[model samples]
Target: MAFLALQKDGTQRAWAAEHLWPDCTPYRAAGNLRSALCHARRACATPVVETIGQSLRLAPTVRVDLHDAYRAGDEVTAGLSPPPGTENGLIEALRQDLLPEWPEDWLVIEREQWDQLRLHVLETLAQQLQATHRFVPALQVALAAVGIDPVRETAHRIVMEVHIAEGNVASAYKCYQNYKDMLERELSISPSQRMRELVEELMPR
Candidate 1:
């Protein structure tokens, strides 16, 4: 819940005991809440979670890397790539899934949201690279998107587009065919007409 609050606003948030301890109302008496807050403060080497007037929040000094990465990914998606020397690191950061080991319901929703955000960042970067005629990196980014979610047709489409733009018509056809087969096998459905037309446009005369 602390994580969720920080993610929502990147600041300390005040939540009533009822909000934080929804399942344990009987145990949320003033003395018990004070003891719990003290224990929380002691559990960490430095002060982290803090209580203020019957509400709880992380200390002002704490900063979370996950939030930073999320903002960076958003910036990249909005056409603000990192400086030249840092592009590789930024791309690697964008590739990571948030809290992959956590099984909590909120974390599950956040994971899916972050995954889609990362996919969008990759697709945007790939398109930017393609516009600059940097075909190799463009293809790599598109391929990474497909690896993250094979069922995402836009990623596969981007891969095929990169291949065709690079004069690899045969590779483009093969990519489309492979995606077509996967869709048919996994979902019992055919690729969309737009995807089929893209391949057709790249077909050798």
Candidate 2:
């Protein structure tokens, strides 16, 4: 179901079955898919999955949280605020990983895709908030990105930017030093020249 949702065009039933049940024989996989589809249909009050002639897809009417988060991310990336009433949950939505509890092998790529997408979106959203002078939420969102990937230089950079925007020079410098040390300890490498330059501007000559 999630695989189908990720695909722009719904996938062929055979392809989905094969991907979802890679270890099973094709015949068994197809049977498993059918059963799962039926179960999904019955479990939902409204349709969650829909079948066409030879393909299956998430129902057009289904409201998926990841999809909503992607739309919100796109809005912020485009410099537009998310629609009214969505502000409260935007951070939480961005914090989520795609189906973390599901241990299916097929989910690996999907999870990575969402992880990268959400990280980009979160960083962008935080920058947008900072640019608008919404410092509190900006720092919160930036820190959320850092929490997701501690070694991600971009996320750390944004954290520093948020601190600087709030007139917290000491905090910003501390953040840079901490990240610099983390990179050395974790990756045995130093921060990039771009990061160093950002921090250099913060230093008094």
Candidate 3:
């Protein structure tokens, strides 16, 4: 079901069976796929999964939350306002991992892809909010990105920039110090020169 959902163009039953039950024999995997398909049909009140010839996909009318998030991120990157109520909603949505507790090889790549996309969108949204003096939500959005990947320099940079925008130089400096320490502790590295320059600009001559 997830395999079909993730694919925009749908997938062949043979291909999906091979990937989903890679450890099983071809006959066993095909049997498993058929059983799973039956369960999927029985679990839904309306048809969520659709079959076309030998390919499977989510029905066109089904709403995928991940696809919605991707669209919201696209709107942010394209310099468009997200639909009503989605500004803060996007922040909350990006804060979640795409099935973090799911332990499957196929899921890992999708999860990582979502993580990267959300981080980029969060940072961009934070910058947009900051440019318009929406400092509180800017900070919230930036901090959500930081929470996802603490060592992401861009997210921390946006965090510092948000503080600096509101004349909270002390808070910005503290954020820089924490980020610097985290980098050292986690990756045995220092914050990049760009990050240093951002903080250094706040210091008096």
Candidate 4:
């Protein structure tokens, strides 16, 4: 499945048999490649995978979550607000790690790319919620972003802003202090000056 996914795309969907099995020396001698392709064709009863001129192509009916998530994230980043009542589910889907169990280098790279993309999406969603004065959901999205990448200062800052907007000065201060402690303990560094200023602005002094 992974191999086929790696090969498929909108413009170029087919992969030559030679490309799929570069070393046909042994397999061809034993007729293993032919037998395997035959079984694969049979297994794809719905015809999602079809042979075209000695190459395999995935049908348009096939859809991948990774692709869908990316497209949605792009749309969100491009200022397309998600429909009401679907924010939580969309956020949850974006939070999922891509192919966590896969140890392949390609999978690792793609996973990291998706992770960053989702973080951006989360941050954007939080900002949109904050703009609309939806502090509760904004806070939730900010916290989820922080949970995914604890060292991301933008998420921490959004969380602080949401708490402050909700009139929870104490909670905002506590969140800042916790972030400060975590940064110091983990990276031996303090929060950014801008972040410190934000907390100071909320102080009673």
Best by lDDT: 3
Error of 2 at 8 (Å): 5.1
Better of 3 and 4 by lDDT: 3
Could you estimate the TM-score for every candidate? 0.80, 0.90, 0.94, 0.80
Q: After superposition, how far is residue 175 of candidate 2 from its true place, in Å?
A: 0.7
Better of 2 and 3 by TM-score: 3
Q: What is the per-residue lDDT of model 3 for residues 52-82, given as tens digits with 9 covering 90 to 100? A: 9998999999878878888889888888877
Model 4, 30: alpha-carbon shift in Å? Answer: 14
Query: Considering summed lDDT, which 10 consecutive residues are worst modelled in model 4?
Result: 10-19
Whole-model lDDT per candidate: 0.75, 0.85, 0.88, 0.78
Off by over 4 Å in 4: 6-39, 50-57
The clash count for each model shown is 0, 0, 0, 0
**TM-score, structure 4 vs. true:** 0.80
Cα lDDT tens digits, model 4, 20-40, are 454555445336545765787
lDDT of 2 by residue, 52-83 (tens): 89888788887677777777788877778777
Error of 4 at 147 (Å): 1.5
